[model samples]
Target: MSQVFIVTDSTADIPDELVAKYQIHVVPLRVVFDQETYLDGIELSPATFYEKLGKAKVLPTTSQPSPVEFMNVYSQILNDHPGSQIVSIHLSSGMSGTYQSALLGKSMLEDEQTAEITVIDSKSASYGYGLLALHAAQLAQAGKNAEEIEAAVLKLHEQRKLYFLVDTLEYLQKGGRIGKASAVLGTLLNIKPVLSIDNEGIIYAVEKIRGQKKAMERIIQMFEQDFAGQRINIAVGHTANPASAETFISLIETRFELGEVVYPNIGAVIGSHVGFGTIAIFVWPA
Candidate 1:
């Protein structure tokens, strides 16, 4: 039987335990603080990245992995598996070029260096992408073929939803990920902006309200409205904010029937832009 293998980038932020359990391969994005460089999840952890961000003289920046990086990782995996296929999933193309790079790298390999490889743009971020990858890995382990696994994850992607709260818009503005004017205005207004990734894979502000307390309430309100009385799979993501995550999760458990709950800290690539005190929740059908 030809086995299906899974690969993803660091932005997925899938918990380390799940990554190890599923034997998923992860290629990392880059995070640069001042003149120093670090790999997204490897060299710079969420806690470390947030600490640097709090006191850095100059703001950090991020870059997607080069195609060569993907090619190298793919070559190694294929060499080990002989003829198995690769289902390479990644963060949204709207946010990074990692998906495009995965494609280019697969094409550059010699025919024998790797067998068939499929690259997917997850159209989500943080644990949202991670959940898709997690599900894909599970399917692959269950003896599904590459095509079957890919289709399953694509269907799941359509159902994926995320809502995040940012403590401040300064990092987003400085990173150029958010509109400066909007960031400035939101900051001045003391709005706890709620953000979501659209179907097209672009991050857009969903709503803006005052204070963190009300913002958390709004997230639950939206969740209850969308998936009420239904069992759901969820991930609660944090950026150096465990208490906040626990509080939000406690509220979620009270409102909905949760089938699976995963806790993963945001990786540096995302933290470089969103900064600390960021809590995001992703929900999908169980």
Candidate 2:
């Protein structure tokens, strides 16, 4: 039986320490500001990205990892592990081209003497995708075969839920993720829209509430109604909004018995679209 290696893009929002500890390979996306491009989480850290984000006159743009980049990682893994299988998990194709790039890379490696490369579209982002990658890596580390690991992750992926709150609709508006009319209405009503990832990994507005506090309360209420009886692995993501993230964490700790609560800083690619003062909660059924 061959070993299995796990790979994911930087949008997973996984910390560098954990990436190294788990031996997970990451293909970085690019973030461009003012015609200068930097690898997400490679050349730019979250803190640095946010600093420049605030100062820059133009909004940053993001690009997925190229097919060549993905091929490089896959080739190296094949060289190191000989016939090992590779599981490349990534953000949703609906939102980014990372998944498509990975697929192209797999096609390029048809002649390689490996078990196979399985490219999975997490249909989610940030901690939601990170959690799936983490679980897959854990399974790979435990010597599970690629098929088994993929099966395990697929089960968890179906049960995962991501909810987020953005401080301003400007970033989303600029990205064309939300309509201009809706953004204007939201701004006028002081309505903070609570957003979620659908089964397809596409982001959609679930509800619009009056204030940030009410939005948070509404998130907790929805969690209670939908996930009350289930044990969960919770992850809170923030972009320069530690206070709000902490408040969400506190509420979850008080309300549920969770396996663990991970606090990961949102990385540049994700931060660029959501912008500052973004707070998100990722819950996976335990």
Alpha carbon deviation, residue 41, candidate 1 (Å): 1.5
Global lDDT of model 1 = 0.86
TM-score of 2: 0.95
- Candidate 2 stretches with Cα past 4 Å from truth are 112-115, 179-184
Per-residue alpha-carbon lDDT of model 1 for 1-286, expressed as tens digits? 9878899999999888899999999999998888888998889878888888889888788999999999998988888878788999998887788899998899899976545888899888888889999999999999999899989999988876789888787777777766323533555467888888787887778888788888888988998888878899888899977787788888889888889887889988988888878899999999
lDDT of each: 0.86, 0.85
For each candidate, give its TM-score against the true structure: 0.95, 0.95
| CA error at residue 205 for candidate 2, angstroms | 0.6
How far off is residue 286 in model 1, in Å?
Answer: 1.9
88: Cα error in model 2, Å: 0.4
